[model samples]
Target: MLLFDQNGWDSRTYLGGWTTLGATADAVSPSTGERLGSFAVATAADVETAVDLAVSAQKTWAATSPEEKAAVLRKAAALLEGTTEVLATWLADEAGSAHGKAAFEAGLVASEFHLAAATAMMPYGQLLRTGRPRTSLARRVPVGVVGVISPFNFPAILAARSIAPALALGNAVVLKPDPRTTVAGGLYLAAILEEAGLPPGVLNVVPGGADVGAALVDEPRVPVISFTGSTPAGRAIGARAGELLKRAHLELGGNNALVVLEDADVEAAASAGAWGSFLHQGQICMTTGRHLVHESLYDRYVELLAEKASRLSAGPPASGAPLGPIIDAGQRDKVHSIVTRSVDAGARVLAGGSYDALFYSPTVLADVAPGQAAFEEEIFGPVASVTSFSTTEELVQLVNSSPYGLSLGILAGDAYAAFELADRMRSGIVHINDQTVDDEAQAPFGGVGASGTGVRFGGHEANIEAFTETQWVTIQGSIATYPF
Candidate 1:
């Protein structure tokens, strides 16, 4: 059965099942400015109710057998794989993702579910050595309920990464997806899991604005918070979570760097750079925000990058354009402002620095320096700022200068040299011959500094750590006599 249908958009936000709140908001298509449908607008009270229900359901879910949990997750994965095209269409219509990016995200959601299913079957504890005549072991247990706040970009993947693992590990989740992408990010997952035999209250979707998110973070019932969004918002969540003595897994913003060594092929390097910067209109957190090329090939690299940027046209994803519209006019204006300010600061726009409505042209800026806005800040747009470096030390300095250290990429003829360079870089993820915008379901994905709490998501180990708590238990034949 289809998890989502156009007619199902009404009362899309699922607290336990498809239900409506006191208020509702329209889910508008960013690419066409058409109303897809309305979704429930969850209030602070709604968030509290969702968390309360999750807490009640988590106990029974935690008592379930690992095999049963695994079976449910695997079924969910199969369902997602079967309906990839349907979800991809939602992604394109709701989040303005290009067809290719939308399809990739749809596939990624299924992959995440598959990975979580495997995690459910993995060993949950380890035996410990003890000196006394006692059996001691450490076992993993659920963290009660997890509060997940996900962004619009790669909505399904980001939310599914945290949600699937948490549920597989027997913890219920109360997810708050960005209001702009409620259908794809929130309701879609809820629908699939419910159909796949997920019990009521095990996964809750409450789509709303900032107030709703703050309520989820502040709820005392939620002992863990998994947030993916801007750096500023992450900082606030981290601080509040700390005040509540709760664990927070934050995957925040990034101004990732792509370094082209002197020996690198200029054409290949340019291709990687363009893909990293322009894919999904650079809405990705791991987008290549800065390009640091060696002085020898810098001019040619810039020229090729400019040509690539100029060739890409921004329009609706249905138009078969490689680049899609910005999420809204406000975001388009923010991107254009950064480009204009960078140009004002002496950086030349080599190809594009323009927009029509919400569609922004893929822009390339050359001679971007340390102090320039485009180079220093995380531009969540299809804008590539190129700079030249003469030495390894200079390249390292350039890469580390940014406040964000999410992802780094190095392209060089010598793999050993690239590895050594990666060692010196401060980023959480490094690619030797690839771009910054990349991820795998099995990799430990996160960043340091403003990017996120380091290594908090992905892989079996990280997922277990993020969603479960370790408890030490001792066993004996009977109650032993103890001196009191």
Candidate 2:
């Protein structure tokens, strides 16, 4: 609800709504380190209020039939689809993303809703064919109140990914979004859900920072904690949830690796690598950070990638812009420092060693050695570091040695070669001849190790993980009459 001037001036707003200044930081524009509006920090009392409302509403919500839940979710999807243009514009401005990227993310949010709707109404467990002497059945039931803590990057889509499934299963959600981009996506979502006729308190939005989130997660009324953030943060939340005996679904950070074999198409591999590393300024958890190319083709692929990355222009978030600024100044400086240290450690900056505040040129580095910060950490920025490997064995060993295992992308010609490399990669999801960030609605999208603990996105994975619980209906007659 706030806009800044072109001369890097600031503004303020007192929009009359249920706003919570939970983030505690000013909502500064990435393009111009200028304050757009004051982000109020939500207090523990506010979190208690939100959780109480959700807990009060959950009983009725859980009693509603699955078909009713599906109807509401589907209608919400329709409303979201209708508001793509406005939603994308606001999202781009708030999050500093390209218009096209924002629109695509909005569209995906709508699609996830529809998919979750279908999951809500789908038939439950199947009956096994047993002897006529006994009868047995099973059912999938919904868990009660769920607490959703979403991150700033991909705010809309990621929030939708968790909320839709939780709602579809008839659980009231208390969502504590990252204060930085809460207005970017959550407001439109709440409006659409309201238009879809969801009852009050079923999807409560509590805008706040870490303290608010901590309160919600630790509350006894919140039975499930669904978190998407850094690994350290996730571990902290998980431990607290464990103390309370609450279920936790965590999606953490990653340092993904891209492996290119000698037989791979150099041009195609380079293109895929650049797209995976530069898209969203490499903020995506699945974005490729480490590049392992066979020595035979490493030089050629590096050259191609450098040329391609140098040509990418950084522009405003308006329509037709190829790309936009990073999410914030802190992230920009982190990336800059990592790149600078890598250069000092003998890595050569192949291209893009300059920056304009929030915009770091798409960067590529070569001659990267093991244990360097750029090679060791998850540089979630528009940067990729290339390393050489003498054989597929060496490549696999190097990638597996990292403490993190999220997603890995392997580039090779022969099907067997790709499969072989993928078989040895120590990651949850593996992509062959494709970019690592390419996600499908029906696939189990998540990570392993430092990346995350459970699956996300809209699919059987979400349905089974969100609502379905195993129940055994046993017959004593079966055990007594069974043949010995």
Candidate 3:
């Protein structure tokens, strides 16, 4: 039987000790809108129970050595690899990912787990000299239970980014995944962790929506919230976390740009831009939504970009086109509206711009002006907007004008020139000779301004530090006498 049979489902909430059936949420295929099955929807009360259990179990888990934790992560990585095919199928059905994209997401899950395992056993902590006579040492300690809320775009991999590291650092996690892709996000997640020998109550899965998420956030026991979703929702979480004085690590929206400089190879830039703009139907946060070209190469770059985008088709994964449908009608309609409005506002559509069913053709819009939606907003779809700039200053202004500062890409002839241009761009990650949609498990991945909450998902000191707190310990060689 298929792992994600549409006929029926056996979804349930994974509590600390056992799985329990609860309120039902019907899962539907994004590609066809067909009912996949009804799975349990966890409530606020259920969230409380899960958090309580996690808090109880965190004590024992925290005492476990980093090596032991790393071993568990390695085992989980192997188990995840074993379920690659099934995981890919579930993601394709629920998240509207093409076969290639689904496979990539599944593979990334295991690789990120391995990286996090290595990070767990690495040397951390330091002995500090504060110009004091006492010997001082800073040690890392777990930050209690962590609440992870993931979006549907990259359900398996994005959530694993936070979960693996948190567990590796001796902190338990309570996950609340998006309702749209619950199976790939939450249902089997706990099972895999348990199978990897994770102690019960160390990790729990509660599939829920907004209210459930709010409950998780409000629960004072859960000190840290790692969320990946829209910018508006991110702001809300940030505000609430601020009110409660809790830590929030958010990986939110992006309106990234790929700039084609005068010295760039038009064909190469166009190919990279097309892939960055249309991959996974532009559902990725770092998808290049805007294309800024130098006046010298604007026309040629636009022409090549249109040609490359036109060759791609949007359909099922088996169709062989690198593109696929949007997550659902709502997202599809939004993309269609952006294209239509851009066209009405004098932006010319050089390639396909229509949709049949849930599939939206890859579109390339040229002569996009300032007022156009495609030029102004995060059109999270298979659409790319092209505009021209005379100088690097103008290009920087155009890229930084967007309220979102997620990422930017520069296609320059010389590496030094590319890095120079990249340094001026106000994004978290700047790519030279590559597209903006790139992520690694060991990089400081996140955005600035509206893109994220100034917190990184992985890489360097921040990723490991996010899950643990530093304690300053000082000891004296001899006991001091106090005068009464």
- Superposed model 3: Cα runs more than 4 Å off: 1-9, 130-133
Ten-residue segment with the worst summed lDDT in candidate 2?
6-15
On residues 311-422, what C-alpha lDDT tens digit does candidate 1 reach at each position? 9999999999999989988788889999999999999999989988889999999999989899988889999999999988998899988889899999999978899879
In order, candidate lDDTs are: 0.93, 0.79, 0.86
- Which candidate would rank higher by TM-score, 1 or 3? 1
Per-model TM-score on C-alpha atoms:
0.99, 0.90, 0.96
How far out, in Å, is residue 155 in model 2? Answer: 0.4
The per-residue C-alpha lDDT of model 3 at residue 320 equals: 63
Models ranked on TM-score? 1, 3, 2
Q: What pairs collide in candidate 1? A: none
lDDT winner? 1
Question: Which model is ahead, 1 or 3, in terms of lDDT?
Answer: 1
What is candidate 3's lDDT per residue for 124-212, written digit by digit as tens? 68899867678889988889999999998899888889998898888999999899988888765666787788999999888887999
lDDT over C-alpha atoms for residue 52 of model 3: 88
Off by over 4 Å in 1: none
